[model samples]
Target: MRPPCDPSKFVAEIVKNVPPSGIRRFFDLVSGLEDVISLGVGEPDFITPWHIREMCIHSLEKGQTSYTSNYGLPELRDELSRTYYRRYGLDYDPASEILVTTGVSEAIDIALRAVVNPGDEVIVVQPAYVAYVPAVVLAGGKPVIVSTHRDDEFRLTAEVLKPAITSKTRAIVLNFPNNPTGAIMTREDLEDIADLVAEHDLLVISDEVYECLTYEGKHIPFSSLEGMKERTVMLNGFSKAYAMTGMRLGFAMAAPEIIRSMMMIHQYSMLCAPITAQIGALEALRNGNDEMERMVREYDRRRHFIVRGFNRIGLDCFTPKGAFYAFPYVGATGLSSSEFSERLLNEKRVVAIPGDVFGEAGEGFLRCAYAASMDDLKKAIDRMDEFVGGL
Candidate 1:
């Protein structure tokens, strides 16, 4: 005799509603296909620098394998405090104001859950990362999408953001050098948003994970603005800058009350980030900037290479100011983004994400992440030429 087969009780409605990450789904499909060239993933191609890897090894050797404090190891928190002020001009008391999470990815989730109540609204700017909407849904908040225009370089302007606010609005998620589009917000843009948040008294989740990868100008943390530090939870990590994605560590800085509140949720959801990874990230914060500079310089070179190649090949692409993606307008191809992407991959073996994955506004574009090798990028460009020529 077997127990009753009511496995549906084991599944959550929230998990069922969450679609697979659109970027990763394409990567998986193209994985075993012969002669595939992928520009689809958002991870850096660089290996974690040897010194950071050594520090993790040292931590493990010293029996630093125990679980850290829910908020994270204090020394690492202090290092993050120093690094935050030193790098971004944002000051936070690491002990009371920071909560380390698995990655900025989780930092986004927990912070949103802490702030948003059921039926509250969370404003998401597009074309944004794929995570924000689902996180908002799981937290029982409604997602109010604010479209950012390509003609305006896809920035989240104050003009674009203000009208979307209402009495039920709980928070706004800000990402820059943003994912998919690689557009960054300017200081003026931050000031306007800050003024809005101040007027409406809204919380902010500012994701600046690509702060170290900007090419056109400096990366400005929205939390660094005058009144925003109190209202904004700054989420960032070593993944993009140090090529330490697999290390699975990130930190959030906010008002002490907000941090304390989120910590309770973090304590339950995840005990703490991996002890070994925290050790490596702390070392990266203290000593890895030189390596970061080299990587940014290399990415800058690849940025120019991809943008120029796309322009020469008849794709209308704006120069990305931050992050390692090239969002090129593919409207002239006379195909929808899905059709174009599928045809390109199947015909030319070149992989890129259809921009609609970011949002409906992204329909006429394709996001080609340049975080692959220079040779791979060059090969992708060659394949693009061959594919477009056939059209």
Candidate 2:
């Protein structure tokens, strides 16, 4: 009999060390259960605007099924360039500085792979998006985590970031309007960070995927900061703003050389983003502004309702200034984040992600996405109150 192949020997050590996404584990668990109210996923509850969907269908009918340029359709890039300039007062050469990818997720992966050298350190702020550390690891780099606190509204300041830098530090990952914790950095905050990055001569991967979703103040583009454009790779997409998550369209804006390097990786791995999706993205940029505004307004309404509801229920939720999630302190329930989440799911039939899944600092909190319907949100809150009362 042939000996069983040792899978451990064949699998790359780096790949093996990386854990599966914690967000998806709970998502999959709750997906199988009936009538469960889920606030676990950070996705928009709205569908893609009908015009955008129709544009995709129209493109398909017109035989626009062929692959786009490896860097993506030039027309789409032009629109992105114009939009960025108009929205954030930043200019990018559509031809050289922009490259479209499957999603902001892919933009992140390729950007890290393009810039990181083996053993180089990438400073990642926590609680960060789950993909950041693993993407750095896959690129043969070390992720130096700097935990941000709710006391400071989870903002990564120059003081917190400076201590994490070392001789080997090559880059910093900044995600404002951040996931899990919807914290945003003010202009002054970014100015401090920008000065630090300039002094250290470090590259920056700025994930502004939630830029358009900011509530309390305007979203600032990191690359737009003085002396930072050349050093920053800005990632954004249509997923959250246009409610086109499943369409998987995202873009990166950086210096020509950095974009060139990312394109080399993207071309080999992805070839091109789906042409139909590109067409839809193009339409979204052109005509989806009013719809985007409408969605944001609705989300704002829900945001206020949910934050108030959580605090009233004794969960002690800090007001989330951006993104669709509320990271409420669940420590009062005398349960660890996982225990609280699991028990809540099992007994209340309402799902919220355990915050520690985002980082160790997230242990006493739970991430509750407010993207569900008002009716569902109300129902979940009521059930959660009952659960907390029992505890």
Report model 2's TM-score to 2 decimal places. Answer: 0.98
Q: Put down candidate 2 lDDT per residue, 103-214, tens digits, no spaces.
A: 9999999999999999999998989889999999999999999999988888888889899989899999999999989999989889999998999899999999999999
Cα displacement (angstroms), candidate 1, residue 359, comes to 1.0
Ten-residue region with minimum lDDT total, candidate 2: 23-32
lDDT of 1 by residue, 24-78 (tens): 6676668789988889878999999999999999878889899999999999999
Instruction: Give all candidates' CA lDDT scores.
Output: 0.91, 0.93
Local lDDT at 156 for model 1: 84
- RMSD after CA superposition, every candidate: 1.4, 1.2
**Residue runs of model 2 more than 4 Å from their true location after superposition:** 1-3, 24-28
- Screening candidate 2 with a backbone cut-off below 3 angstroms (N, C-alpha, C), the clashing residue pairs are none
Quality of model 2 by C-alpha lDDT = 0.93
**TM-score per model over all chains:** 0.97, 0.98
